[model samples]
Target: MSGLWDIRLEGSLETLSPFCVIAPGAEEVTRANGGKYRRISRRTLYRDGLRDSRPVVPGSTLRGRLRRSAVEVVRILSGERMPLAQWHQNAIGGIKGSDSEAAFDVQLRITLREKNPVLALFGAGSPWMTGRAAIGDAIPEGPVETDLIGGARSDDGRRDGMLFERLDADAAEQWHAMADANAARTRYKKAMRDLNATLRAARKGGGPEEVARLEAELADLVRCEEAAGLMSTNPVSMPLLHEAMPVGVRMRHRMMLTAVTEAEAGLFLAAMNHWMRSKPALGQHESLGYGLLRGEYDLWLSPAGAGDPFSVGQAQALPLGTMTAEPIAGLSGVPERLAGFMAAFREAFRSGAFDFRLASEIG
Candidate 1:
């Protein structure tokens, strides 16, 4: 889980100009004279069933691609038949051995709305014009049954169900710290056993002098373990004999749900904003500097709404307005909101809300 977190917005891509040239001999050449506009792509660690970020769509820069993932997650969590994509219908049909799981098809949709109307209409292809690229009107008004490709309707699909209820932020942070601490302790205990085995082997093979030497080593190991606050083996730490511990351990996993309090959601979004705007963003942005054309650059973190609940984050890049950050819930800087988010996800997965299994070490 320890890795760089990246969420970025790239805009102002030069539209490729298609041109044709003809020689006196009647030979013609058609060439493209523009560079691909820099697109928004997220880069974060992929662990468990979700991406490393709070909302989990880094590989996709287009709003349509990102919203597709959201819709899928929501559907999976809701236990409903998700709307199928062009290719998805073939794969998502309830084939027994297919990759598709009827229960895993749930999706969540992410829509970014802007307070400034000018900021809402920036498009790379059309320059100062608002292009209907990804998040056009296609972005649903709270998860409805309007056909994205065609005018399709689903009687079974629930339009807009409130996913999360706002919760305390500070409490959320405390909960995650507790869970993280427990995870670290559990790992420490297994490491101790391996080190202890070395000491035990030395004592068994050597004479009386060796026994004394091994005892000293054993004592040192215990001291180190106690210093790390893992002296006793708690039930939580008992089942730790695994070779692929890093991959199989629950600490490497994460879950995201919409059913969080506004404060809790805010903390998650704020943290993501902080992480994205930090020094790391500079490196990521520099990689796409060419497509940016010329504009003042700065990243800002803001809540979805304190006054109007309908407002969301939108990305716009043009002469009048430009790209904006995603709208996160929770304005109050209470840390507990994070704790609650982590706690809820961990509990749900650990209790088998999702079909995840740890590849425990056999030997």
Candidate 2:
């Protein structure tokens, strides 16, 4: 016998440090100042019959973070050294080879779900399956405040707390090499453009010999450009600016799981547990002390039908505080419920509910 239950988590996240998830195409190099800057991601919404643009942490981004954390949990708890790339594809949905690779294979997908609970929960794309989980964008609870922060990279390593007098000869050599590589990249780009134009003209009226020669030159220029790109580095001693949401910004978020088995729910909850335990960070520049966040959530699990295999009761409240130092046992009101779910996950794992061997068979 099989049963499913619905789970919902309502949450709020507060940034403990500066955070920035840049808008698409918003990071650009300014020709006037030769400086690069990024702007925060935003979406337009209507409120009180008026349109307003607001900063948003995209749902896709949150899903990606959770998926990564979940994969890590799976790795640790399963105690198996499965191929990470293939396992990730199975858990998170990726194009195996072509989009239609699994277009006609239905039994394979059913077998996949039976073997891999993580894949069953998260779904896959090649065979066009729907996932049980859904995450909403984190929208600001109040007015969004932004700050413009600036940083610099010095070739002399002075900005990294190194003294200019102690700069090594290798630093100077690297700087010159990077500069030369950048120059070569620019030259290759210009030459490629010219060659493309010449090729176009040759295709219209010139001989095949001219066309072939221009095509070969353009291909060679492309290879050279790629090589130069690998060696090119950012201009040192220049300021880079980022528009970020400063600390203390609070955002409300929601995640939902529909029609999931206890084992599947446990798998997700276990991942969330690991994520909270590991001090999860979001957005960008975590190394620069940005994107640190504190999360608080109230989880609600709907009751399973009578005589069903599921055991959890209705309306159980689970409060999750990601940054709290208190132990699970020390916390009030919901530790037992959480522990129950975790135990279910553990039992399922012990019973071989999750099979990593199916990873290689998934498209």
lDDT of all the models against the reference? 0.29, 0.68
In candidate 2, where is summed lDDT lowest over 10 consecutive residues?
Answer: 323-332
Give the per-residue lDDT of model 1 (tens digit) for 154-203.
31112323312244556556545555666777566556666577667876
- Looking at candidate 2, what is the lDDT of residue 169? 62
Best by lDDT: 2
- Candidate 2's C-alpha runs over 4 A off are 23-34, 99-102, 155-233, 303-335, 359-363
Clashes of each: 42, 0
Residue-level lDDT of model 2, residues 177-219, one tens digit each, is 7667656655665676667879999999999999999989888
Candidate that scores best on TM-score: 2
